[model samples]
Target: MQMYNPEVLGVSLRHIQNRQERRVCEVMTAELADDEDFCGCTLCIEDVYACAMSRLRAHYLHRVSIVLKRPPPNDLEIREEVCAAIEVVRLRPNHASVT
Candidate 1:
């Protein structure tokens, strides 16, 4: 039995790294835990650069990977999430809720 649970949402990142995802998850969870939350989108530079160097173009394989140059961002209000998804992601209504 769960009582008083906040809504859980998904945001796509480039790649799921141990160190980086930990930070991103922590920050995002905290932000969403609050009331009156909407949505967020995350763009990764490392993912862009990685595919840029690879044989594949940024749009083909269809997935995004993540690298953490800085600490996770706090309280991102995402109206739209647009990035290079090479691997695969389930694009849904929530992803478009922002912009």
Candidate 2:
């Protein structure tokens, strides 16, 4: 016989995003904002984020205490990925004319 767990029904679990990854994405997006050549549309930003996320390892901490205990490193690896993604977006932006 197995006991039923009632807590599972009322629990609203949320995935805590890594602050460092957010920061990296923010910085890259801000940098791209200054770029007149590249489009700063919502889809484009999401594209950039997707690209960077694919290359960067996610640091999901289950608890807020754990997140607060340590600070994330300034990762150059993520920066490089964002840089490459920027180039890709620049070369083939979604806003390009359908010629």
Worst lDDT 10-window in candidate 1: 77-86
> What lDDT is obtained when candidate 2 is compared to the true structure?
0.68
Clash total of candidate 1: 17
Per-model TM values vs. the true structure: 0.24, 0.64
Those runs of model 1 whose alpha carbons end farther than 4 Å from true positions after fitting are: 1-18, 39-99
lDDT of 2 by residue, 1-99 (tens): 585443556774445555556766676867786787777777787787777777666666566455344344456666777888877776777776434
For model 1, state the Cα shift of residue 36 in Å. Answer: 1.3
Residue ranges of candidate 2 with Cα displaced over 4 Å: 1-10, 64-73
In model 2, the Cα lDDT at residue 48 comes to 77
Instruction: Report the CA-based lDDT of candidate 1 relative to the real structure.
Output: 0.32
lDDT leader: 2
Instruction: Write down the worst ten-residue block by lDDT for model 2.
Output: 64-73
